[model samples]
Target: MDKLRQKDYFLFASAMYSQPISCSSLVEQATSPFVSFHQRLGCFHSDWHQHEWGQLIYAEKGCIHVNSRTKQILIPSGYGVWIPPDTDHEIRSTSSQTNIRSICFPVADNNGSLRQTISVFPMSTLLREMIRYTNRWNQGPVDEAQATTFLQTVQGLLPEEIDKAVIVYLPSTTHAKLLPITTYIQTHLARPINVQWLASEFGLSVRTLSRLFRQQLGTSFSGYCKIARIMRALELIELGCDNVSQVATDVGYESLATFSNNFLAICGHRPLQFIHSKRLY
Candidate 1:
């Protein structure tokens, strides 16, 4: 993190750690075939755990970070992650004022492609509206015939919608040498980071460091840095950072046009458009 944002990030991290809530009551109940819960959170962390049922976690206002053993996915505002039953995972809030809506499903409730895997997908306008409508169920014992049928219709639409999954996941690694490097990159995204600088700072030769990133993280050093910058940029935008130029610099970009171009390439929307869309939610 840059010096300018250090205090803000510290507060975010501290608040996130200080406030943790359990979803056991809502997730473990057998009384409902599907249950939905909504809560507004101030950047918090839920340490590693697994649910007895599958969960679709949506962020209506901010961003969520979901981590499994293999990968870490970022669900930006207006997006959601579907985690399968019994899948060990951890969730962390990425922005203050994260409004989370989660719908839990029994093991037998789904049999399509959406079952059995963790997927981060975009929530279309129609799906977002439908999910908002379920606020009436409010952590439901949604066993009523009409309510169940409507929710079923929502569940039925998921498989098709998931085909539009966005690639917002950060590349992760377990290598002893690279783990700290990746973590540092995430925390210091505003710095001018490169393969040569990281190689020297970490006491590894340039060739070896470059090779490690490709072999272990499945991306080149520059590629991983690009992904990290764009992800941080999105999180900042979701947190209500409205100045395009300021956000560009906050993520280590020197050129506004360059930042905007990269943001469009990864997110399928320009930064300003993304900022405008956040207001709709």
Candidate 2:
């Protein structure tokens, strides 16, 4: 097996905003338990980076792709990606114009295990609104008890476990020759894509590509594609795509029956049923 490169295994981001003069920072600057909100423009690019304080990253208006050492998470609006402090991760906007709102908090104590991986959570509407309100309080000396109470309420709502569907972990190898192929498959899910073409484009043998997929993703290329398609379908359904047949076609499945079968197999329910339940919730 080929050895992984350090650069390939990690992402780097250079831009970060440290909070100023807030009680969260004032009281806890040494620990740096503070919250700040940001609006990122279309051209902004945050390379891979880590911080002393764990971060709660949420998107108020857009979506982002987050990659930790172990997995990659697609954080859309209403979802937040939690990074324990000192975990190496990268972030990029899915849309050209992306708007993000985030809260950075210091962990009560430095626990190395907590910083080991990315934990994604559903950002409930109430929690989102509360963060917005709390950010309004100036960073000067504030009532410690009230501030602590607000922080506790924020922490209390975080779910113990997050249900995530699509996550890609980077290998130690620096070879990203296969990444373009994966990116192509993700971006063109609605269209027909074949291994022969992918291999040809990358100047690699089909067998080599297959082996790479199995090694890097722990699944066959076809399986990865199906999972990716299902994830996209779920996102669309959540956004009010009620017609399952159309969604199936949109995600590159030729037959509606086949799409339904695959969707049921992966999601354990029919697409319509899933969407209906989501609506009820």
Candidate 3:
């Protein structure tokens, strides 16, 4: 196993120890056929870790943010993310009242085709109810014949459901100069954030800033802004800001029509459509 980063370790320790009994034991010593953890938490972050079993992380209320080295995925409320076994990643609760439900699947039980990549899938009523039922075995070997069989049925339904995954990953950067700029964009999503303005604020030339974004983040400033706004809109909707027009304005869009078009282009769903879908779960 790879060593945990220093900052990752500190954040993980702080969050895990706050629980009534350390849930760290559940994650680290997951020898059971299946294990699940359901907790209502405020803002939370986990340390870098990998499991021998594939993991399904769901947020019943807010949004779940899953970060890997290469990508950052936002799993909105009523949705879940599937992490393949042996994948290095960390999970975060992006909203204040996040209800996180995590279920682990042994290698033999997970979808073979999806065993190598992470995916975010919308949870159907059947699937969501099935996962919620598993809250029965939060600390578990879950090896009983009936329970194991039920879990296997859920595993079987995954590959088909995961095909409907909505890929909404916000751009991220670790470059020293770009990191602060990215952070600024996230906090100021309601502002008119342009490359020229950012360059002036960060004391870099516009050309230099554009080049840095292209090289490090593989996107233009405007491109990243669009992604950031839409992803933030998703988080807002998950947080109970259900007005489409309000969400559009909050994320820097002056026109509701434009916001709807961009939301559709990016995630193949209109803002209202996404909200309705979320309500179904």
Which predicted model would earn the best lDDT? 1
**Tens-digit lDDT track of model 3 for 136-211:** 8755445567777887787788888888877578656778999999889977888788788789989999999999
Q: Point to the candidate with the largest TM-score.
A: 1
Alpha-carbon lDDT, every model: 0.79, 0.61, 0.77
| Cα lDDT tens digits for candidate 1, 148-266 | 67867777777877777777777668899999999888888887887788889999999999899889988888888888888888877766678999899888999999999888887
In candidate 3, how many clashes are counted?
Answer: 0
Runs in model 3 deviating more than 4 A are: 1-24, 94-96, 109-112, 138-142, 145-148
The 10-residue segment of model 1 with minimum total lDDT is 2-11
lDDT of 2 by residue, 43-159 (tens): 244556777666777665444667666555665455677777777766765343356667666665534434556765556667667766665554555565776677666655554
Q: Give the C-alpha miss distance for residue 246 in model 2, angstroms.
A: 3.8
Ranking by TM-score: 1, 3, 2
Query: For residue 177, what is the lDDT in candidate 3?
Result: 96
Badly placed stretches (over 4 Å) of model 2 are 1-32, 38-44, 69-72, 94-99, 110-113, 138-145, 156-177, 200-205, 231-244, 256-281
lDDT ranking from best candidate downward: 1, 3, 2
